[model samples]
Target: MLMAGCAHFAGRHPLLGYTEKDHPQADTALVVCAEQEQYICGITGVNQVATWEKFNGGKTPWVRVLPGKQVIKLTLSNSHQLNRQQVTIDDVQAGHVYRIDVGFNATLLTASYTDLGKMDAYTIHMPRFPLSPKAITASF
Candidate 1:
């Protein structure tokens, strides 16, 4: 899994991706992964409503997010179509993997979320139609 962080540390690389050896004491950890070949995508974060990490080529990006209502969307690199998913992050404990995958059904896009640490699973169907300009703008 590929990862990125906000603040930089001295002599530390701006980018880092690796498994956490120790227990990470936090509210929640979100791992957004997409397997669309030849397509680049990204997941939106809460602050400033911007895309956090770009899923380029063959890497999965992860970040730590607060436990609350979070709107996650995958923006295609070369298309206007956005596969969106709304997740209510509640009862998520640290040291667990909450994985979300963006996939397609025929031509329509979809999302499947699973907590590997538990028995929870969820599937969401993205919007059939492209979002209107006003509908998209109000979100930011």
Candidate 2:
């Protein structure tokens, strides 16, 4: 598995396929699967859909995609179950960063997105699954 620590150093080489080496930061949009405690989330596929051999079992936290409408596949998991969810973001702007947030809302496993680049923050609800309270609580 590939692991990326939250650190950076001068002259350090970038991770091939994981860094912005190929996808320039100024023209590509980034989808970040922020680490969470309530559940585990990972980016599985970006538009142009590559093979699972590069998925690293969803351990990679972020992916770069061309600006415009893009479909992202993700793996979401809690203590009781695992699921794959596909989210479509329309009119994705270049040089902007978007984040996928997954959480349990007492009744369902919820996913949403936020445009971090904007000041007027808003959340777009994505796929959701009905999971019982017992199942969610068991994780604790």
Candidate 3:
């Protein structure tokens, strides 16, 4: 039953990469969510983001964003509970790649990013709490 539900969701939202018809412009930056084994991390939204079909193509997890400041909404799950977070990039530059890593340690959730341009990293720690099943479902 679980597999069937996942298949249904995947059919509705197929992952794709950048293509000529749906590729990012030269003046935009790319942001990707780093997959971790201890937790599940995903990019739920981007700034003024349309559907996930626009930025992600070719089966990639990265999304394109305009230069300057951008806000990315993310969801982190550890099977039992789910948490939502927003990470802001103050100076996103064009033609550069950025990666956001979500980590779970005890009751804390940490989000970090490294700008590929400077290779500098920053981390944001958020308190994690268990949510009721109804609350988790409502997040969708």
Candidate 4:
């Protein structure tokens, strides 16, 4: 079931200098196409305005309104921690609206944020991939 709200991110930052190979779980994560879906996969406690780490535990997908002018920071966890991972986007201008899509498990999530603070978070549960429709070949 897709939870209809802003949810938290899970796991640690690909384990430092991690690559696609390092991420055994990457395959388990929903496959996302940039054109079909828009999202940013970030780690919590990694990128914070206060600190300088870029990869931490947890995941946060945030939309930037007026990026590079007035930025907003977001963090997530796997129901264990809260905003522990500090991922910060700096110099986000104040005006332009952005839609960020995050891929996790069988769900595609989103978060709306700005200089003010968190606005809302929602989830779009994804259906099984390699769609059954596409699996069928056209006979015509």
Candidate 5:
């Protein structure tokens, strides 16, 4: 899956250097993608903003991150509406690649990933993906 995302990114950014070969020394790296769907994703940590993908119909590139056990919040928005889901993976380890697969359909929100082939198919208990955070935050 690592190579798959890398191949798709042809002329995007040089920072898309995400592979199973070389990794960060101390901190873990994060790569999030919306699969089988499209959504505008906003990633936030504590009070810091990480990244966001708007009208993302495909998977996103890898996002480098610090090593720590923290709760990273994500708000996904789409054309229809918006939704929010906070996901916490295991310990963020160094030299490891953390991939997040997000998707949504008519009924269920699908979020899952593998930790360097260490973890199995872990399902994220969320309402749905393809979620647009715009409408939701606007409600506030």
Candidate 6:
């Protein structure tokens, strides 16, 4: 997994596999903190049986953050096809480890929560192209 992260961080970020949404080539550059964790949640309904259950099973997935430095360079791959983009990582911390998640317009997904002062998902957006998992390149 670390090797894969290094490859993605050092080598070319892949764009060959993914569900293309709007275009054949769409991507964004992202800078994120890397951390490892396992999350599990269980909920019981009125019947007292475990109705809702989910677990991360002690897995690590890259999560995004606001760049604390001035500008962090990232290589983004197009979502539909093979491509790359150069972006600035704004308001994100440097050398800090965080669970990073790379995806398109993540802010929109949790806008209501953010506005309501709840736990909100951090996100970054690019004008021409947004960040997608297919374009994420990182070193864990």
Q: How well is each residue in 1-140 modelled by candidate 6, as lDDT tens digits?
A: 65444433331221111223342221222223222122111111111121111222111122222224322222222233222222233433323333232233432211000011112232322111133434334331
Say which candidate scores most in lDDT: 2
Every model: Cα RMSD to truth: 13.6, 11.3, 11.3, 17.5, 12.4, 18.7
Q: Give lDDT per model, in order.
A: 0.39, 0.55, 0.54, 0.27, 0.43, 0.24
lDDT of 6 at 108: 22
Residue 94, model 5: lDDT of 50
Over 4 Å off in model 6, which ranges?
1-68, 78-80, 98-140
Query: Best-fitting candidate, measured by TM-score?
Result: 2
**TM-score between model 5 and native:** 0.45
State model 4's lDDT. Answer: 0.27
lDDT of 2: 0.55
Kindly report which residue stretches of model 3 are placed more than 4 angstroms away from their true locations once superposed: 1-24, 50-60, 118-140
**Tens digit per residue, CA lDDT, model 5, 1-140:** 55435433321421222233364333444434333346555453322543443323322233545556645566656667666666676576555555556677786455555566323222222222344322110000
Worst 10 residues of 6 by lDDT: 109-118
- Candidate 4 vs candidate 5, lDDT winner: 5
| Model 6 accuracy (lDDT, Cα) | 0.24
For model 4, how does the per-residue alpha-carbon lDDT over 28-130 read when each residue is reduced to its tens digit?
1211112123343443222223222322222322221223332334343233233321223455432222333233444424333333322232222322233
The C-alpha TM-scores of every prediction are: 0.44, 0.62, 0.58, 0.22, 0.45, 0.21
What is the C-alpha RMSD, rounded to one decimal, of candidate 2? 11.3
